[model samples]
Target: MTTLICTLQDHRDDVNWCAFSGNLLATCSGDKTLRVYSTSDFSELAFSPLSGHGYSVHCCCFSACGQFLASCSTDATVVIWSMVSGEIEAVLEHPGRSPVRICALSPDSVHLVSGASDGTLALWDFPSKQLCRTGTVNEATLVACSFSPCSQVFVTGSTYGDLRLWDLEMRQLHAEKNAHDLGVTCCTFAPSILSGGQVVQFRLASCGQDSQLKIWAINKFNFGGYKMHLLHTLTGQSAPVLSCAYSSDGQLLVSGSVDKTVTVYDANNALLLYTLNQHERYVTACCFSPTAPIIATGSMDKTVNIWRLEDGCRGRDGKSVPEQSALTSSEGRKKIYLPIHLCIS
Candidate 1:
């Protein structure tokens, strides 16, 4: 079971995206700035708004190592900030006026990729902080991009509903397809690890305006080159799906939609688990924390909500959250899914 933990309220305008590194949280906003906070609700590790973007910051993500934060904005710029120093380490501007919809960092945090509404994609060498390559999709906008957990391949989703996979090392398109009937809003890759620390098939989840979420499986063990196969189409969202994320263990999948609800599903079984309908407005963005038992969501209502897992709700393996009773139940003498809200720091 999941319960709302904190209402991260600070953005003057709509919150566009939220991400977490360890217990630290980061949010991008339409107010043209980004803010970071501590999950523990303690002032010992909190800070005020960090404003430098010339336009709305569309998305932000912490690097794999959590040592750096990368954000993209409508100002055609991507800023890389050092987590240790709280200072701008580098600024990368896209070639044109088109807003960079989102950006992703390689698993090793050695490279960065940004996508724009004009269907342009640019790859940057983080060591030198320079743009090294570029590509374009057939659609009107590239809505999302994500690097595989293996750090070898990357995927891009387009506004016009196109999906493409690319080889990072070879700098070539690995696979391309028209993924959805409508615009693809978000995409996320499953973690590389499986049971017993064994590496197996690769999987991806993507949400779109079609009001459907699709899970794609990539079988690298194939004798031929790896190919994408649609594994499941998870439905129930009545409105356009805006954002989605797979839990760190790849057992649970969560998605936010224009329907003003957040849905969670059993990733392996594709069973609908829970729907969090707490947001009054469209839920724009969401992500799972790397080192915490919580997930954070951002919305057009200018607030971020952190949903935390109960102590006994998750499986001992830490991969799955067991199905709970529809009404209510007790887990180890504690009321499971006890609704609560907190404003900290």
Candidate 2:
């Protein structure tokens, strides 16, 4: 069951995105500010509203180790902050002064990459802050970029709906495709664990303005190579889907939409597990906590909502929750829905 724990309203403008690092939640906003909060009490941290950007802060991401944070802005610069001190450690200047719409750190935390509005991707040597390489996948702007779990590959989603996977070590294309009808807004990867712990598959999830969500099996066991295969498509959203993420255990998937609703899915079977409608405006961003069952969402309504599922994979006493047939109700499109295990407490 999912319950709204609290609503955080620290930003003066629209919160662009929210990310979790350990037990702390960091949020960036159009007001050109960044804030950190404790996931436990939803209280503002001492080093909140960390201001350095001269323009709208588009996104913020934490390094895999949670020791550093990287944030990009319309000011054409990416700022790397030391999590140890909550202070800016370095500033990376983007070429051509293009808006650095998104930035992500490689999983190994050795390289920092930034995606610009002009459709270019640049890699920086994290230690020295030197531009190592810059390249373009295509002509359209890259809207989202993230590194794989192994850090050997990275994926990019374009404003033209282009999805491309590149081998970071080899600097070669692994796969490419037109993933959706509209611009792809987000792309996330999670491990697909086989039953009885046989094999682990890499899966990719993507969403966009098309009001659809897709899961793709990225690495094939049959072919013994990396190739994307359509796994399933989840629909029921009436508006464009904006963002998505997988739980730390990869047992659940969550998405936020322009329809002002957040939905959680059973990742194993692609079942609609919960539809949360608590935000008053467009849900611009959503993410799962690093080590918990909590989901955090940021909205244009200038608030952040945290929803948690207790005993995520098991029932109250450690046994698995018994499954029943899907429920049918007359609420139609106007009502929010949740599974039997869902709760408001």
Candidate maximizing TM-score: 1
Model 1: colliding residue pairs: 117-141
lDDT of 2 by residue, 1-345 (tens): 556655676688998889998767889999999888766566677877789999999889887778778899999999988777789999999987889888877767878778899988888888788898887866788778877777667788888987888765436456456687878988888743342233345788899889988888766344335567789898857899988888888878889999998888877788777777777799989998877777888999877777767657432321221223122223422212344233222
* TM-score between model 2 and native: 0.86
lDDT of 1 by residue, 122-184 (tens): 888887988888877764788888888977788888877877888764355555456887678
Q: Provide C-alpha RMSD values for all models, in order.
A: 6.2, 6.9
lDDT over C-alpha atoms for residue 79 of model 2: 95
Flag regions of model 2 displaced more than 4 Å: 169-172, 191-200, 220-225, 314-345
Q: How many residue pairs clash in each candidate?
A: 1, 2
Model 1 lDDT vs. the true structure? Answer: 0.78
RMSD of 1: 6.2
lDDT for each of the candidates? 0.78, 0.77
Q: Sum up the clashes in candidate 1.
A: 1
For candidate 2, the 10 contiguous residues with the lowest summed lDDT are: 317-326
